[model samples]
Target: MTSPDQPNPEAVSDETLFGADVADYARYRPGLPDAAIHLLAATQHGVPDPVLLDLGTGTGQVPRALLPVLRRLVHIDLVDVHQHMLEAARAALEPVRGSCTVSAFTGEAHTFTPAMPGLAPTLITSCRSFHWMSRPRVLAMADRVAAPHAVVAIMGDGSLWTHEADWTATLRRLIQTYLGDDRRAGTRGTYAGPGRPYEDDLADSAFSDVSEHCFPVARAWTPEDVLGYLRTTSFARPALFADRYREFEAEALGLLKAHARGGVLKEDAEFTVLLARRPGGAA
Candidate 1:
């Protein structure tokens, strides 16, 4: 998953900050929990084949997870600012093309223009990537492009850096020692927490009928898997450390190995989904 933090106050481009890590991201990031998909599907029960527009669809994790459950979906549009990430998402969704029309767009979440006319999405989703967006702008864009009564879902779980497991805490300490206490993102900036909760943003937008759901997920990680996951995160992308990348890896692995229990570290995360829809009925 890409870091939700804006690269810097200077406004670095998402492609420059995250494109290089697309491969690792596609390989190692966790897919959305089944409950999230179920909730989304439930919201569309009576609708016919619907169009799904996923913004910041890094490697298509959200679409891929929903594919099996959203069998009736007629079209899926994946949008991202990074071409590499878009390419990866297209590749991941290729197998499902026989079931639905799948297309990709390279642009910001708030500014994407669908290629076809009358392509208003019936469901819009931004997983993990919502934090990187101009929330109000994106919501305004959603209001413009979404079908009436369309559900806009924003989902995320805390990253490994924030996990509370002993091994994870130790690992985080090691990262802080090398990268410093503030969470480093991209090349030169630290992550800034959102000033307000996403619920507030949705409550104030056109999609004001808002609800939230959380799913409990237990994850077991081997030292190697943990390291691979690190490669995909904003806080530990190799480019952020440059020449010291290998050295940092070696030290981090050693620390992880020391803390692992039976070659695995366990963490429990609450995957939260916030669902919003316009007050009026579907158009």
Candidate 2:
């Protein structure tokens, strides 16, 4: 969902963005921190028949992370534009399914409504995928789909590129050397970044009451892990490098190896979650 947005954008289209990187994304992308997971599940603490609708359900990461902790979560509806990613999500969640049922939709998050009537979500979540969607529209949709006490949780930590570290700086330079001065966005040219703070977006929507949570997350990455992660990023995906992608990868690996201590690279990040609710809403 880090890809650049074109005019009249929906969720980042699979064919242009992560069509070939879905496997790498599922394998290498870190799960939400345990503290974050507990907090999400805690929001549904008193609700009856809690349902979770993950708006930009990339490979079902948010739901997968929440399901194990949320025994009360009876149903999960995942929405993403990419069928391939949805297929991957469906397959991954199959082994974990117990009493709960999972359904996936391939379309804009703003347009999704549960097929079963009177089935509003107890919690609505948009993780890393929120920035790619039309923010205001999605929030308005959430207002309609969410129960009176439900909260719309927007969660993400900045990617590796945003991390301020020696290793990340070197990696960025390497990517710039092969690509260009700007971040390479899939199909849509350079990334312009999400201009407005997501907090502002929430304030402007129906969900005006917002609470923020910050979690300290420390991650260790091997050179191999870093390589796998780069494959999932729009800034360094193979498609952006043309025929020289192999050359770029070789150089990138060498640089990463040089930086690794005990064959490990460290990333410390602040993961933020904004839990938004309507005025006087409880959750």
Tell me each candidate's TM-score. Answer: 0.92, 0.94
Which lDDT values do the candidates have, in the order given? Answer: 0.82, 0.84
Q: Model 2 over residues 127-228: C-alpha lDDT tens digits?
A: 887888889999888888788898889999989888999999999989999888998888768887889999999999989999999999999999999999
Give residue 275's error in model 2 in angstroms.
0.6
Clashes in model 2: which pairs?
none
Q: For candidate 2, report its TM-score.
A: 0.94
Per-residue lDDT, model 1, residue 11, is 26
- Sequence-dependent TM-score of model 1: 0.92
Error of 1 at 122 (Å): 0.7
State which candidate has the highest lDDT: 2
Q: lDDT tens digits, residues 155-178, model 1? A: 999899888878888888888888
Cα-based lDDT at residue 244, candidate 2: 98
